[model samples]
Target: MQLEARKIGFYYKKNRWIFRDLNFTIDAGEIVGLIGPSGCGKTTFGRVLSGYEKPQEGTILLNETPLPKRGYQPVQLVYQHPEKAVNPKWRMEKTLHEGGEIDRELLEVLGIKQEWLSRWPNELSGGELQRFCVARALRSNTRFLIADEMTTMLDAITQSQIWHAVLDIVKQRNIGVLAISHEAALLKRICTRTLTIH
Candidate 1:
């Protein structure tokens, strides 16, 4: 399986292209890093790849086909801000189960305590909430993961734990990962190859 962005272009305003004619691909089981300076549209590209936003030109293809308009998307995105990603009204358990049934082993690997599941999103620390967001995005149907600065805000220990769990799952499931971040050391540690946006 492969997720390919073919000659894609996007802009939020007229005559201002954040990125143009960009082509990229991530094959199944590969970990690709997207690294660039701040405000270079790396996050925008991730959104487009994950089907959260539409590109102004070109296409995003999964296995040479356009992405599905509805239903569970194979390309999932885990953003940097878990607080903004989840609903405030729902408990952590509900949010975690939104994608599908929660994998007990996954929870244990990510260091998510069973007691935390009963708490609200606002009740958890940033790192704790992010673990849930990561877990939710790794549902069985996910073919690719677009992690846009997913661990940037967490401390070194938390970041290491999350990446360890994520990489383990990626290897076991053969899921491709697109890691977007400005941290060169982190990228070098986890990604097989790196793509620069600018």
Candidate 2:
């Protein structure tokens, strides 16, 4: 899927307005980074692009086809915090199972061990949890990925490794990515384009 947000604007009952007339497009084999201050709606914008939110105005299109108001397929979101993103009771295998038919090799390529798949979420480290989260996302036939502050919590080494993992997925899958990050240098290293929001 190729994603395009056209003049989008959004407002939630709990907060101020966001994305006042924004515009951008990202296709397969490209990564676009979004940067902004906290609460400037960078994550919210990612959610909207990933089909988690519907904007009040403007269009969200995939391959020039108007995306539905709800239920987007073949696109997935990887959140900033992995611990909160996953279910405490669910085993690693269970989470990836939800996405269905995932190759065990894919997990290995993401730096996940097969033995660890049987463990619960709480047993994993921050970086390991994030890898599980990514594995879950990749289990689906996702063509567009929205990585909202995905590497902000990990150490520099793990962050770099995971960034490369994501890049590898994009390359092999011929996917498009909307990577939300505040670190300009790091974002530049991975993304083909970067847009700073407010």
Candidate 3:
């Protein structure tokens, strides 16, 4: 399977385009790196691809079909900020299971403690909250993941741990990944190839 962005165009305002007529693709099991300057719409592109936002023009296709509008989305997105992605009112466990019943093995692999599940989002550290986010994005039906600076805010050790778990899961499930970040070294180490946009 492959995810393709064909002639994609997006803009916040009428004439100003964050990106226009862009084309890109990532095959299953491929870890593709996306790098660009600040305010270039990389994050916006990810949101569009994952069905969080609609493109003003063009289409995002999965295996030549439009993304399913209902049910679990095959394309999942993990943003840079975990705090913003999750609900403060819900406990970690509720937030984690919002999609469905998450596998215990996945929780174990992500280093999510049983006790942390009962606590609110604020009670946990950034890394811990982000762990739940990553696990949530890796449901069995997820065919692709758009990791927009997913681990940028964490320490080096925390970053390594999260990446290790995520990489292992994606490889096992043959899920495609588009890792958007500013770190060239990280892209070099994790991605099969890197794509840059202006």
Best by TM-score: 3
Residue pairs with clashing backbones, model 2: none
**Ranked candidates, highest lDDT first:** 1, 3, 2
Candidate 1 local Cα displacement, residue 37, angstroms: 1.0
**Residues 95-148, candidate 2, lDDT per residue (tens digit)?**
767746688777888999988889998898999999988877876468888988
Compared with the true structure, the alpha-carbon lDDT of candidate 1 equals 0.94
Query: TM-score per candidate, in order?
Result: 0.98, 0.93, 0.98
Q: Where's the lowest-lDDT run of ten residues in candidate 2?
A: 66-75
* TM-score between candidate 3 and the true structure: 0.98
lDDT of 1 by residue, 73-114 (tens): 999999999999999999999989885797799899889999
Task: Report how far off residue 54 is in candidate 3 (Å).
Answer: 1.2
